[model samples]
Target chain A: DAGITQSPRHKVTETGTPVTLRCHQTENHRYMYWYRQDPGHGLRLIHYSYGVKDTDKGEVSDGYSVSRSKTEDFLLTLESATSSQTSVYFCAIRPDRRNTEAFFGQGTRLTVV
Target chain B: AQSVAQPEDQVNVAEGNPLTVKCTYSVSGNPYLFWYVQYPNRGLQFLLKYITGDNLVKGSYGFEAEFNKSQTSFHLKKPSALVSDSALYFCAVRDIGIPGGYQKVTFGIGTKLQVIP
Candidate 1:
């Protein structure tokens, strides 16, 4: 564990409802990322933040938004949840160094019905 | 953009037998490669990484990976497989020469390793 915690390890929400997943890190790393894992497709990056209030989208960032107000917290928001958005979400943190590996949280399993 | 690929969906190996999981990557410049393993219901754990220097890199849990620049591959190897080694493995890559303040690591689809007793 790299001092990372993901809230609501498991969640269930109705389709079209709003959902937010939180990732909190204590390491004070400059880079943080949110990813969704699905069968047949490993881990797809949803969004990543290089610094506070600085974020960028990934390959599958559609319908998903992220906000990093502080160094420790990175929030991923699903404006309108859909069945396709149901997956295991992971939050990762790493130092500014490129050669370093990223540390992951336990992961959040979300289901949209 | 840097990308990684795990061609095999699953690999089976008997206990005490050598095992390998394939991974290939594409990057324009020098690539930083990594391997991570995930047990059931847990987060991914870092296994090893290939930054530079030697082509062979060793990491946690008796696992090693050979990085071949010519072939564009980084294949994980183990001298002997154990039942406890069965898990989902992921290969990730980060391109250092990318024109950006941050280089995101892209992961492969993952390969399931089953070490039979």
Candidate 2:
């Protein structure tokens, strides 16, 4: 509801293949984040971008990478997908202001075989 | 590192009964707390947040969370539960200070709330 959209609502891929998930926002927020949701892990941050070309690793960034070339789009890529990388991915955006709320995308369900 | 904990994995309540989902947080400084709800197959929806000011914060869908500094807790509450209220709830926290900026939020494992009809 916050002008956020995640492409490829559902995806299924085999192990060792490359996968990419895209998040688009219209709010022009300064902060964008990629997160993965597992059954017992809740949601863990994978990567975040403070601005275009400015990104940082999150708690769970081992198997994933992110790029934010423009203010509206942030992409997450899994170089060589594995079964353990299968999860629901979500994108979040927030303003630069401290303590501001973050908005989430609908989520992409990725299954690796 | 900032972290959040939702002690209960599942909570069951009858319709019209009061319901609560517990959450506790740990951080270096005063933490910014938040509650979010997620329906099956949907994204997380913002419920409420405790930035400053009043300890009692009211959020969407008749939900409220009380921020207790002494206990380091922010438990979500509802006066009467409804079948429609059944969903997964998550608690999150962010530290006030970080090198780059406001630290990224850390979410709990989530609590599944089931309101029986």
Candidate 3:
């Protein structure tokens, strides 16, 4: 409801194949994040972008990459998918303010076979 | 490094009874704490936050959280429970003192709440 949209709400891919999840925002927030949710693990950060073209790895960034070419779009790429990588992926954005709450988009459920 | 923990995996309560979902966090300097709730097949929504000022903060859906600095805890509470309140809840924290620390909010393993009628 924060003007954030995630594409391909559900996806299945073969193991070792490439996959990308897209997050688009209309709020023009300076921060965007990618996270994966798994049972017993809560939501683990995959990657995040603080500003256009500025990105950083998160707790579970291995085997995943992200790119932010413009303020409106951030892409999460799985260079080579694996069964262990199957999880619900969420994209979030927040205003630059220090205490502003982060808003989330509908999650993407990805499966690797 | 900043982290949050929700010790309970699930909590059960009867309708009209008071309910609480505990959360503890660790971070350097002053920590900004938050609580969010998620319904079935939906994204997480902001419930409340503890930024500064009052130690007691209230937010959406009649939920409140008490921030205890010495204990490093921010536990979500509700006066009376309802069946509609059943959902997964998460606690998060970020370091407010650092300028770049606000970019990400680390989450705890969610606790599923079941309110029975």
Error of 2 at A5 (Å): 1.0
Alpha carbon lDDT at A50, candidate 1: 90
Comparing 1 and 2 on DockQ, the stronger one: 1
Show the lowest summed lDDT stretch of 10 residues, model 2 chain B: B96-105
CAPRI grade, predicted model 3: medium
| Model 1 stretches with alpha carbons more than 4 Å out | none
B1-117 in candidate 1: lDDT tens per residue? 678899999999999999999999999999999999999998999999999999999999999999999999999999999999999999999888886566778899999999999
DockQ of the candidate models in sequence: 0.80, 0.78, 0.72
Q: What is the lDDT of residue B25 in candidate 3?
A: 97
Candidate 1 yields a Cα-based lDDT of: 0.94
Error of 1 at A60 (Å): 1.2
Residue-by-residue lDDT tens digits, candidate 1, A1-113 = 78999988999999999999999999899999999999988998999999999999988999999999999999999999999999999999988756799899999999999
Interface RMSD of each: 0.9, 1.2, 1.4
Kindly report the docking quality category of candidate 2: medium
Q: Evaluated with lDDT, which candidate comes out highest?
A: 1
* Fnat of every candidate, listed in order: 0.73, 0.78, 0.73
Which digits, one per residue and each the tens of the lDDT, describe model 3 over residues A32-105? 99999999989988898989999989989999999999999999999999999999999999887567888999
Looking at candidate 1, what is the lDDT of residue A4?
94
Which has the better DockQ: candidate 2, or candidate 3?
2
